[model samples]
Target: MKVPAPNDDRKGGRVPRWLRILLPAVLIVVWLALAGVGGPYFGRVSEVSSNDQASYLPASADATQVANLQAKFSGSDAVPAIVVYERSSGLTKDDLAAITDDTKDIADLPGVHGDVSPPIASKDGKAAEVFVPFADDSDLDTNVAGLRDHLSTSTPDGVTSYVTGPAGFTADLVAAFGGIDGILLAVALAAVFLILVVVYRSPLLPILVLATSMFGLCVALLVVWWLAKWGAVQLNGQVQGILFILVIGAATDYSLLYVSRYREALRDEQSRWRATWIAIRGAFGPIVASAGTVIVGLLCLLFSDLNSNKALGPVASIGIVFAFLAAMTLLPSLLLAFGRAAFWPVRPKFGSEHPQVVGPHAKGLWARVAGWIRRAPRIIWVVCTIALLLGATGVLQLKADGVPQSDLILGHSDARDGQQVLADHFPGGSGSPALVVGPASELQPMADVLLNHDGVSSVAVVAKDSPSGTAPVTADGVQPVGAPGSPPPEPTTVDGDVMLQATLSDPADSDAAEATVRSLRTDLYKVDDGILVGGVTAVAIDSNDASIHDRNTIIPIVLVVILLILMLLLRAILAPVILVLSVVVSFAASLGVSAYVFDHVFGFPGADPAVPLYGFVFLVALGIDYNIFLMTRVREETQLHGTRQGILRGLAVTGGVITSAGLVLASTFAALGVIPILFLAQIAFIVAFGVLVDTLIVRSLLVPALSYDIGRAIWWPSKLWRTDAAILASDSDPERLVEEQIDAIGAGGRPSHHHEHLHQGDREHPAP
Candidate 1:
């Protein structure tokens, strides 16, 4: 335990002082330039992003196929905006006149596609509706806002108006995600800054850490934005928000590990140059291993059938890669530039006695906890396991099958309110309709089949010559709304197929409507196997199914992939398996608790099937990070001090930094709740809670206790186990040997000469 002298250079070739200073300066300038360039892309992300659910489905999905074919028949993809005008009493003549005039005026607005449908009054005479179509390529939010503005100013007295349908919902969704670029980032950064300030009690260190995180995010966004603009990847608000949080959280966590190593190194090596190298060498293994685990785990999403899920894999992986680079390159340069001043007011003095080696009386909180674990390791792990299991039982109550599209946005929604109004007075699916595509020759048969279903209120076929762009199709055949003697309009056809629109008796996003679409597809296929049923409801069904498919398929793959990674990093089978199991249990418990809270406390209708999938990915991948940090150090210590003493020393030393990292990660994820989207909010709660559980309970108590109880076998089938066993066997009394080692460490002296078998290099420069 003889401490190295300050600024000592005798053990290696000396680096030129000028080069040392120049190197850090160059790196800092390079990062600053990169950050400056990437900064503006944050506001430009929406330019290349899309939130359309139908567009994210796989090409092989029925909904995707029907959507593509329907576009062919219409010659344009138009999103329908249903305008509903209602009076509690009855619609007056003035109301009808004003609605008709409003329809005409709306037709002239920019992006309005085709002809607007004439106003149709309901049988109750209390409500009327108009169908306005917007070209898909246009700015839906801008056009929808204009339409709403026009209605707000021109609506008849006492007649309330609402714009709701695919277009309206799209607009609202866009507005909800609008906060991602500004408010969300602000909240996440503020939370992280506060936490860093509290943890470090040093302003300079927090600023350096925040710079590393921000620079990483800026560069990552730059790459992702161009990829999206070039059509190489799809970007959406959800993916964008996740990328920001992931890069910031992962980068900060990595920075914390480096800072910890640097502080520890400075105590042993006074020269900033030598200290920087020592810190980098010590932190490099765990940081790279941690980032690799998360990146590889995220890439597993490529196996997901859902396009949105697949897009997340590479997008998040890019963020992780940049986070790794910023931590390894940018952060080191910043720290090296300032040296001990980076941690001003709490600078680690050279040759200072290390805390962990200072015996029981001088032990900090983590050391005290480690002592308690050593006394009753089995009981602690068993009790913690039972508590986690009990919490996980709530998973049965989780309603992750799917939620109504109307419920996707949290809080007030004009579109949701309008949908209720439309359902109360008119055919629930007046504006949104299930589309049926089949052979042109079987158009009548298809119409008849649709008409047979109780859920179908009416059916229509695309008609090029019709004023409304579609003519009503009944059991009798296509009906002529023109002059009595005029012939019915010809149905538009594409690739030997005809398209039929079936309006349902329930809202398009309703569970009833989903069932109706499912049955319609089943019944229609009986008549013609080539027939396909799709619409808003069908899109939800397919998206949910694909998400569920991804959850089942990708979860196991992530576990297997992460396990193999752990095995490689730890070089032990049993230890890796134990770590994976601990993380999985932690995920289950987090999801279980979140499910109960979402149902009872928040009154959440339900979750997207992908919610669990995302929670699992983030919690397991990110959650395992603390364990990796702890175990790698434990393994390094075990190589010198024997398993039991090494486990204690590792826990005591790593406890503070690992806990700080967990808090930083959890808080960054919690910031996702700022966006008023249900999926993101649910993800925020689940991941934030899971990281805490893993950090406080699993990593702190469960993993360490289990490893301690298992002893050398935790490294079973590895050379370390045999080497440790031999070290233990050579000592007649293991307990006395551990005490003697602790006393030697406390006195700043080497262990007894009898224990000279330990590696000299490791003795000189221990792993962080």
Candidate 2:
């Protein structure tokens, strides 16, 4: 009496059927519980999220240091909202009286800091601007929205009121990201659902796949929310939106891969439990490798100097972790519970042929792809590589210096409009000033340095003795703003330092303003090394410079890190090198195409430097996933069949699944286009297009053809390089081995017992 092998017995035949059922039930219940808990955290994310520029700056940045020290000098951290009232004609008495009344009322509003600046007439007198300061702890967007409503009602007729400044811009930015938790996510899910329903052609299967993704996202969010709350990580609107899309796309892709394997296994295995186990074993390597690659690649962002970039690294990695977990555990459990019935109209039948596979031959579009690859491997790779290289030439057009804050929000923006009005009549940096902090004794010298700069329209020092918050400073010194006999107002000193606010002639968000601030800071630092420059313009300059530094520093590190991961996963130096190069080429091409689109089509302002950094992280990391999916299968199949045949078989078998995964990822990322922010939109296009390129061209044509041409040497330095022929011969003949194992199970006998019988018959009459 021979016992069946471990593989046969483990699939409910040996293990109790009750345990199998219980396991899936438990998993489903756990995931449902996790989803329930995480679903509510969406709205609560703002509790921990911040858009404060200083918070995201590098610690050592002069702006960051000044931001910290400047906070100590003030009672509260305040953002100024510049309210500009304009009319074609000079302001009438009624308009001036209305503006004065509005200022008084604004000072009483919640979150208002100090006194609202009395309406200061613009040089043209056609416009008057009021500066309203909002405290740091306030809900800035809410307060600004309320203020807008108030202005609409309080302002005199024929005078249009526009809010523009740091506070106004922040409100617009926050409002732009407002859709992330609702519309962005809903659209992404709906798109994925439609795609899944079409791909599986089964109502129940799509639900299971979506459930796995939703639950994965929920759990990942739950963890991230707490992590952010505890200050273990930082959360922002941009990062939050990416996290939701990335997790959903990644989980669904992993689920699809597993579903495909489970469906294939169901054709041979009699028991659902057995098929699920077999599917898990078959899918485990690629799923883990793919997720690991993405996780490690994202984590490479830790090297970034910008806190936002560094924060995204772990935040997104955590999302990937849960996505992998849900795909492996929750999805498998759902499929196991549903069994063959999950497919509904098109169920996988035991002992029936896999639909994509015809008797003794693979037949389909993928097969044709394989045939074409076999016909001209070198031509296919060379042509595809050159085309990608040509597309990559567009990388020269990418303008990643940085974008003005006014352009940060797409579509209508009152703040941006107000900035234009203010620039037309008043010093462009009317409400927002570049702040300089230095030794109290050096205040006069720092103020002199600021006054002498070409960019400086005026300079003032905070003076405690003045009724107004500040006293004007000329090249000579701080000029008293009081009555003639009053002693010169003393500059307010905090610790040993005094603050000077420099007004710029250019718009605070303009490149000219940044250049001016850069020069002023350079000159002031020479006068007093302790002098620190910060404010809206300085923050922008510093942030952009840091982002550029991060882009340069982190891109190479990410590349090196991902290359090493590929090397370990493939266990071949040459293949990893080739894959890294392929993805880098693919990324460049995607960026090139995006640059053209942004310039000629979208007419977008130059990209933020971080845009390319983010694109590289997502494209290369995610791009390598498809290659991993294909090459791992090739490596697996190569162990059974020779390398050349293995490449063909691997491409044919994995084509539909990998392509579907790529489409799903692309679609989800494309959903980000709905958000209307430049950075996310650019990223959405680059990564989505890059994935398709990898799926259609690189993975389908280039990688397989190149690998086929290289043959077994693709696995160079691996022991398989020397032992390929022997491994191919003694792999128990994969086709015969499967038949023998099935027969042994049917006979209730050991695989050893039926091995010779199957081998002898296979030798006598081989498969086509």
Candidate 3:
């Protein structure tokens, strides 16, 4: 009985190409359907940060009050503009009237919040804050920016208005994305295109490269959307943006290894289909192995204690798998159909017997650099070790923040202007930061100490105040649930509870802001035993704690997962172990460098809490990818040549491909430096630079030297290695071997003349 290999043609003859062409199409269609059906569901779950977290705690509202408040301060639309007016002299009747007119205009704006605060002329009349709220679904930035610009240039005579608070932050976000983000995207695109063009050597090739990656990205996001809507995942806009770049850049990289080899096959065979099969067959082990390593790395995110990290891992893994699927199936089918003709005007002959050295021409400047390292591998290792050590010194200095965007409008911005006015009249906290008031007994002494804190500028004790407002109580009121005697409810009172404005010493993004929060908490715990230290900063700290806790847990889990996968793929105990170790070292080195670049070089607000975590994941996972690519060559060498000679030859053949992919990946990532969101751009640079180093320095030199040093011990008594020994004894015909793919010209455009049968079907690229 003949065993059918899905990957290869049994007789090296014609095979139906339906699955190869159609499976990817079906996946893409299914992915699109999933996205359409599931977008809103995931979107709702994603609103946790903006919804449930934003809702009040420790109280249950009656339906009426729930509806009232739901419509009132519900969603993100509440607390729009707290317009402030300032003048040296106390407010005159004219100034007050002018302020009133502006409030009317703001309140009347589309999607404007109901019940605007009356003109709050200051006690001394020199300043006043007018509260203007808006609807949750409103485009706060658009309206606020327009208003701010209008008010800045057209303040009514002596009266000046400034808008502040959440509206201001929203405006800032819009501006940041609009202004610097475009440049970053463009740079990233240019970098990716340039790298792909140089590597693939065709203008059309880079577009295909990106298209394949984009297809992967779209499918991964669709899966995430499906799972997220059903409450299986969680995401935020930042995650979306980050995933976009990661999937595209990463998928392209994964394809590079296979495609480059395919092109090489074409050059040797001269028959496009023949070379395509050869390329596909030859690349099977290394490509799958490399992908498995990446998948394992991404799966590590599943262990994230943070729901975000956990979700991120699965989503990313989907991307890798789909990309792998696309490469192995979609790419192969396309190549088979087009053949060498895809290369068009150039057939990629490169002479009958190309120079063996891969010298200075298309070989890149790195080959010369590698040659230098090969001559003095020990010295190279010493220098690199020292350099990486120095780079890593900055890791110790890394700090974490939950919300780290620079989201503040200019002095003339609507929100900023509104905020300045509010601050000048009332306290800054009067605008943002909800006061989570509870009973005196519930908070202990926290209230008293917080009242006296230097940052506390105002106090609002709503407990003793009676609500006689004819302003129509929209209160559906809280349900009198779990009441022992069902005490009759009157006007809500907690006089014993303290409502105090807790100010900060600096901007939250600054070092001092975090320090202030820390110091305040310490002082609260020291004196005010009853206080809970509750508010945005408090939530931030909790989230940060969660982030740190998750990182500590997830890293080990991910590493172990990746190691296990490597063990299976390589079928070697020692080889997989060393590969994991080398990759780990490279990851640590990359993180240290990332910290330096972001925290020291560019001086960002430290690393994004997620930044180091991503560095570890990508560096180790993708680093192993290159390791697999290089190690396959080394393994082939050992099988054909001895350890030393094989290592040298493998490096010579595969080194250029690895370096080209790295350059392209790095450049794509480096483009992030141009992104408006400072942290994201920083992340791009860090990851990009890490990829470059992984290819140019680590894989090209250090790994080869180590492989040379290891010899047969790299495989260390694996059954597969033993089986290979048996194959050596029988001297299996190289051309007759049943590979997973029919040998053909690869993406590298190589050619081959020998005939063979290629019998494979849907099993190679299954749809359902």
Candidate 4:
């Protein structure tokens, strides 16, 4: 249960201290190096997405197939920007004049190409769109940001211009993230202060939690950054927000354990250092087990079919691991140096038995709930089952989709305006779907064929060229274009293939896009040799296509993981079985409720692509964590007392802490909903709902009753546990055994030796 101590050869905690500083320094140096070597920063930014599975298509072909394909897209690589003009006050002659001037101005901006539409007024003359083509397709996000900034500055009264397309979506995400950096820091500080004030009853302690968690977050972020730079793993912008939450919440959980126990040791008559060490030993096992459950749950994300989902799981797991480490080591070190004043003003007496979870009269609310369960356990089960099943109806209606970039921004955002422009004039698929790369020879005919297809709104063809002919000159400037349509020419390719560019009416990330893509996927290869489709849409479809397989694999995989962990810890097969089953029920309830809220009430554009998988992994896994906390207490108590009494005792002891943790976690996710972004908000709602289900229904009520009903069969055939000789004398006092932390500030150092001695006495015989 204890952390492995540092060796005598290294003392004064210098090793860990140096590690904390040196690690980040090494990572930053490496990141700058990679950034320097990765060609233009645009190419480097693009490289971040190059390996993402969701950013790619299904691997039905090799490099040769892809090479054979991209040769066709010569003319269309420079996707046009939709220049939107809106006059909510109604477009006047001046509006048109301003729009014309803006379009002319953009024609001269860096990277602009092709013919732009004049400001065509809406039926009500409130809107118009102009088209500006990009001179080159590289560094799309940066280019868009520049364009937006310029246009925003130059826009005149009674008119506005929105530059939107695939490029525009990327631009908006980058812009929204501008504010996110500060918000994340604020969120971390707020969560820590809140936790400290509630649990420790002091401002100083919460500040410590924040500082400790920030240290853990810094390590986690540094690692993620290193991995991102080194091509080890990738993180999306969405990942950044969730990562902040995970690191803070998880690290705070550990901080709570360490500080609370540290205070208990101080009250037990132990010196600061000794009490800190004992607290580590006492708390280490439970925290590790708790964190293990979370880690295992997050690791289940590896089984998720989506790259974003996969990336998120490991990122969260890594944060939790680092937090766990800080809890065991760094936190103990600081608390050892802190002492009795860590809990000031309202100290619970040590060496004196406080009230147990079940009071003498058994008058508390928890006892009453236990009595109801014991009186009609089966009926309670049925009622819970019915309620859960009803909640699960929402899950059955679960809907999911890939979201557009504009979906995240707040109102009146230029990015959203751009998206609206693109949506109105161009097909949504002009931006994100995977491309079907063919040859220049294939492109002209393919565009012709694609333009005629059902989902297709337009097509542009390109061919390969090599010092082929005089480049066509335009007002935009003469740069490069593949030869006119003989298998869209590539700098390097044979005569058989060309690129076909097609745009769809559906949003690049929507189900409609997926459906049309499904149709295209079937017809694409049939046309000729060296034909392929690849793009963001292509990848999203692949992700959606893989959902069935992914879920199939994940269900059994998660079940097995849970079963094994529970069996090892409980030494009983049946207990783990029920535990897993109960968790499954809670998970179903989470999904059902989310489905109703997401699909019916709020009518979200779509559930996050990774929601189902995350829900399963988090709910089932964390659900078991509560089961472990409650059941372990119950089992320990049951060994001495009867089953019903043990149930009441265990519930009384662990319920409050479990509820608090759940509330924190749920609140964190709920906070995501407040973010204007549709995808993040939906993800937040579902996760919060899942956590609530796990903590309230599954953990507090169902687990204890189920344990009682199962009887000795719960630990069947495990004679080792049945023997009183094997286990410690049961004492059901999780709260009293560890001190309830009360922090006070502005003292020279720790509490006096007399109080320290009393705290030490509490540690030796923890029941008091």
Scored by lDDT, model 4 comes in at: 0.60
Off by over 4 Å in 1: 1-7, 10-14, 728-768
lDDT of 2 by residue, 1-768 (tens): 778764464436667778888989999999999999999999898899987675578768888888887666765578878899999888998889989977888998877877788889987889999889888753998988989998888888888999888888888988999999999989999999898888888999999899899999999999999999899999988899999999999999899889988988887777788888878998899999999989988998888888888889999999999999999999999888889999998898876754432112446888789878877889999999999999998899899998888898889988899999999989988888899988998877887788777898999988767776789988677787767866678888888889988899999889899999988877887997778899888888888898999999988988898889888988889889989998888888889988999999999989998999999999888888889888888887676565765677778778888999999999999999999788889888988998899999999999888887777787888877778867555323344454557677788976663455434432322111
Q: Is candidate 2 or candidate 3 better by TM-score?
A: 2
Model 3: ten consecutive residues of lowest lDDT: 759-768
For candidate 2, the 10 contiguous residues with the lowest summed lDDT are 759-768
The 0-to-1 C-alpha lDDT of every candidate, in the order given, reads 0.88, 0.85, 0.57, 0.60
lDDT per residue as tens, model 1, 365-406: 886788778779899999999999998998999999999989
Which model is ahead, 3 or 4, in terms of lDDT? 4
Q: Which digits, one per residue and each the tens of the lDDT, describe model 4 over residues 35-152?
A: 3442132223333433223232223433224433442334434545666777667778877787787777777777765555566565656767666667544355666767778877
Q: Is candidate 1 or candidate 3 better by TM-score?
A: 1
- Tens digits of per-residue lDDT, candidate 3, 149-182, equal 6667656677666666555556554555443224
Model 2: how far is 2 from its true place, Å?
Answer: 8.7
Stretches of candidate 4 exceeding 4 Å from the true structure: 1-80, 86-143, 153-159, 259-269, 272-274, 359-376, 401-416, 422-434, 439-448, 464-496, 505-513, 528-530, 535-539, 638-646, 720-768
What number of clashing residue pairs does each candidate have, in the order they appear? 0, 0, 75, 54
Each prediction's RMSD over C-alphas, in Å, is 3.1, 5.2, 9.7, 10.0
Error of 4 at 646 (Å): 4.1
Cα RMSD, model 2: 5.2
